[model samples]
Target chain A: MGCERYRKYVGAFADGELEVKENLEFLEHVKMCPACAARVDEVATMKGVLQRVYAKVEPSESLRQRVAESLGDASADYRHRPRSGWSVQLRRLVVPVAMAAALIFAVVIWPSVDRFRPRPGSVTVVTGRIVSDVRAQHTACLGRSGGTHQAADLPLDVVGISNVLSRELKLRVLAPDLRSLGFRLVGADRCGVRGHSGAHVLYQALKKDAYLSIFTVGRLPEVVTTSNAQIFDVFVSDGGPLAVLGWHSDKASYLVCGDLPKSELLGLADQIRFADADTQDPTEPVFVRRDGD
Target chain B: MGTETGQGNEDARTRFERVAMPHFDVVLRMARVLGTGEAEAEDLVQETFTRAFSAFDRFELRTYGARPWLLRILHNVFYTMRTRAKRRPTLLDDVDFDHFADELDEHASEPVSADSVDWDQFDGEIKTVVAALQPEYRTVLLLWALEGLSYKEIAEICGCALGTVMSRLYRARQLVGRALRNYASQRKLNVERFN
Candidate 1:
């Protein structure tokens, strides 16, 4: 009975799903209790066996080719718009309702027009460095939260219990309430990228293997404005998961980077708007109305 | 050609390849187990991907990525295939899993006095033990063990409640644990005979 409570967590502990604090707590109990420790070992060992034995059950090259060929031969996709639009009268009739529907979707998804359109024109070294810094910061945050690395090094209050952004960055940065998009604000961190006093609010997808970081750099990192300065670049060598969207208003530069699909990241970028520093509330991160909202 | 509609078409293919294509092998392996035969399974996976590609624009990226969406589509395809063949009725969903869940979990909860037997010794027979499991149990177990998906992700793939995934996982692990324990015991007996 004494060990039964601990035994239920034996699986999660072995799976490494328990948060660092919870893992440390369980580790303390397991050291004194051989029963829980043994259970962990048993479950971990069996899981290893199952994975090792069944991992060989994989698809062959031919199946891959067949699937690829099928995709190639598949009929027109959902975007296969008809060559003809409605008559001009029908277009005028439907335009208002279409705009209303667009407004409804505008709360989250973007029609990709001013979204993450990549403009590599006038690319400067500073712009590239900002992207790299944002990616590194996202990877570092994921590492700390991933339960494998730096668990012991993290402060106990690192996971959303406190907000150091207001005190540390002293910038008008809105973390942008992302809960509607299935991500919970994990925590915030102060970062130094190329001598820029920057900060990022980390958002982990609720029960998913993805993380998003909304980074706001002081002084906008020298990325001159060009067609909204919303250049979205993804280095394929990074295995394509490190897609990042960087944009700048008149002052501060912001980069939204994540391991999520690029469309979602762009949708998040649409929500990131900034207010004039003097007019904005200094004590609180400001969320200005998006253009045409 | 430079119209918004044309651009949307280009983006659809690019996004689908980036998001959905990476999960091809994972879905294929799952299809093999879900379908009765390898050729049929390959056909099913191809059809699933074809459908996914056709509807890629509508597939939204939520808490999880394209993997869950692709898996959900694959399962739907498999179910339709089974329904056509009339082989889907033996799914074991009608069985009183609650009674068996408690019974098996009770036995498994009291693990066999600490797994002293060598796991490598039973590696050959382990696949058999897992294969003997019911489809629902095997599917959940393999998703967790091989794919390394979280319970929530698995629940999304299985289209079941989170608690349902937990109970199914518990039952799956319980059954596999019992088999491993029996193998350990038999291995112990064989060692005793040699000694």
Candidate 2:
């Protein structure tokens, strides 16, 4: 079950269904396993092909109207049968009362907006802090690189760096394959923001003075919503030459910052399979390789 | 007195059109894919809407919006119609999706190399293989890949276990992925021979 063990995840990863942390383990496994690596590449490519080929058929306007017509007046039961008596009197006052409420909320409360802000330790606040940290680090790290070769922690061995980051940050990470977008994984190191440990993996583009970095923390706060939220919903912020994007999957949250246009950063983000992984892979490793030149 | 009733009906129609009509395309799209060929797709959509309209009073606006609610109704309607049309009791619940997946797994062919096959040319083969899938496998695949619904949402819509949704989806993709690779490889061979 060597390949089989990772097969299910390969499918989910292709679909971008794995949690952020779960994605790390799959990424790590794929690096070492040649067969699984090819399998993932194949599956991901096939998904794109299938999506393009699958019939995106829609009902004709005539068919839709006919269906609506068939529903008949019986759907009248859907609405509250036009309430009368006291409800009519109540309806008349609703507009003025709503206006009064809106006016009061704006004048009395909008100024003290800090009170309504996500309390510290909340998912939004923590996520915001993580994004800021990644942004600051993206700036600071590039200044430190200062015409140096990709060395130290992010040595020639990428699999080792992924493992080291996963081991140090206590969450698994692969330096991610961004070469297709003309960026190479330069190196990785562990960093933290306010006690939140993170894997800070850096990428340098073919274009001079261009850099991209990914900061992932396993300390993802549970986002409680009224219902299921989409996993691929990327949270974007801070535009200009540099932009930061945040997204979550499983138990990890990712903050990606790049010194490029928002459009370019977004294009790069599309290349990453955002998901979570605990990075505690208790398996034999294989196929040592390098990511960037 | 009659005017009030007319006004009420108009209000209801407007509300139905607002809340439900917007989702007609998705429901119809899924129904067409789930139905045999395209002829009865409209019939399926009609019955689904009919059922949904009758039960519309029960539908409260939920957090995920009207799409999932509308889709759940469509899912139930599609399976129910298939059972009735076949004059058989192949209830959606009766089939063990896990066992069904196990069967597909046993027969799935080895995957062709990702680099060797240019999938862009095999659009017809992709359509053919997907259409050839069993209805259950097709439903899971379409809902996941085409519809972009989450596993939990799919489970809710299909009225099956979450594990079963995962099982069916995995098996469905495995079959699709294998078939596409095979088709692409076969196409490459044909092109080579002609050349």
Candidate 3:
């Protein structure tokens, strides 16, 4: 018990922390006890060493500037904006007293600007995927017949098509171009026109809200050859002003559907040619399912 | 942007610059032992003033002038940052404490009076030794010897119990004594690790 007391108070003696009377008493104890005295001495030495070292280090210059800048920036943040007393008083009274005035203003001009402007392609990752998917579908269709055309309405199926294309080919293409041009990708199921089982890729990216569909030929029938003049004439010639561009390769034919003037379709088709066969997979791909239309 | 509000903020800023910027050198010196560079110390001091001025609306000048309040703010700011960046690297940690002890012993044996100890050299040696202490002990000694803070005031600032404060102060004093004695023993007498 006495040793415990000494150990607890030893740091105090080393520090000169006791009252004068207590200091004298501790000094007497130290004079008689070697172990306590040594402990006290070591603590005192550490204290002195620290004090001297603490005294010498001064602040450097640039650190001062950065801290000031940080403080100034914090003060200027929008949440801290200062306001006059009168403004606070005015807000308190005006907000409660003028509800009727506020309601009418909100109703008179709210609907038009709030109209749905689709934001599907806003995200960069989605935008890149949308472009790649559209390009690949167009090129693959051009591979089978000398031409191809949408033989059905497939908005319901287009959602499924988006899933299939993303699953099999992993594309994130969007066809909102149909909506702007007054058309939409609307419908589902398989169709055989000119002996080819063509799946419809549809969209509305033009005026009059037209239902445009591109027929992607999965397997070309043996009958769809150079001699099928009616097939080539209707699909390739600018008939009904329903512009279409189609090409055949070793596997299939890809047709882009739209009421896009024949000149524009030809130009778009020329641009599609073939999806770069060597495009690497995305570093990260997010899985998405099309549920509600 | 209100005229009255703008004027009030501007006034506060002006007061801070006049009263606070002048004492930057002293505050920086205090901060260095607390593990700050010249620039960071100055910044800590500046931030201390900015906080004080913003709360000046409640300040009671009758009880205290801006100095003690500003210094307390400065101390709080330094320690708060130190705690937050708990592992921030420090240069003094790179020093070899054992080799430094040897040098102090060699110099202690010379037949020299306290005045004969070169002030600049002594200052340098003392600084190195102080920097070697842990923050807990260093704070106690510096607040007492250099900042002249009373034990009660240090207890309040450090948020420690009175007994704890006293013990820290005691340990601080002992360390200083030992360092000085070690220096003294080196001058002529060979001393063991402890008497």
| Candidate of highest DockQ | 2
Tens-digit per-residue lDDT, B1-195, candidate 2: 457556766775666677777677778778877777677788888888788777765763354456677888887887787777774433344335334433445323344444444455566677788788877777888877655566777788878887778777777777776675456566554321100
The per-residue C-alpha lDDT of model 1 at residue A232 equals 31
Poorly placed runs, candidate 3 (over 4 Å):
A1-87, A90-293, B58-64, B88-119, B187-195
lDDT of 2: 0.56
By DockQ, the better pick of 2 and 3 is 2
Per-residue error (Å), model 1, residue A220: 36
> Residue B54's C-alpha lDDT in candidate 2?
72
Candidate 1, TM-score vs. the true structure?
Answer: 0.51
Steric clash pairs (candidate 1): none
Candidate 3 lDDT over A1-293, as tens digits, reads 24334455555444334444554565556656655665554443343334444444444556557556655654454226756799889977887768767676579655654565322222111111232344343334343333343433444533344333322221121211222123345443343345544555544333332233555543232313442332233244323544345553322345555444555555444333222110111111111212212
For model 2, what TM-score does chain A reach? 0.36
For residues A1-293, could you state the per-residue lDDT of candidate 2 as single tens digits? 45555666655554455765666677677667765555545443454455556645666888877876787645544344567789777867886899899999999987799576522212111111233454465545333323122233444333445434443443433444455345566656555543555556666555543455776554233321311442333333334354455555443456666554455445434335321221111111111122322
Q: Write the per-residue lDDT of candidate 1 for residues A1-293, one digit (tens) a residue.
A: 36555555566665544544555566568767766665555555565566556554556888778777776666343445454555546877788899898897776666565466542221111111233354465655333332121111212232111122222332223234455345566555555444544556665555443455666553232454242456533322245545556665432457665554565555556544422122222222222212210
Q: When only chain A is evaluated, what TM-score does every model earn? A: 0.34, 0.36, 0.28
Ranking by TM-score: 2, 1, 3
Q: Choose 1 or 3, whichever is better by TM-score.
A: 1
Worst 10 residues of 3 chain B by lDDT: B97-106
Question: Candidates' interface RMSDs, in order?
Answer: 10.3, 10.8, 18.9
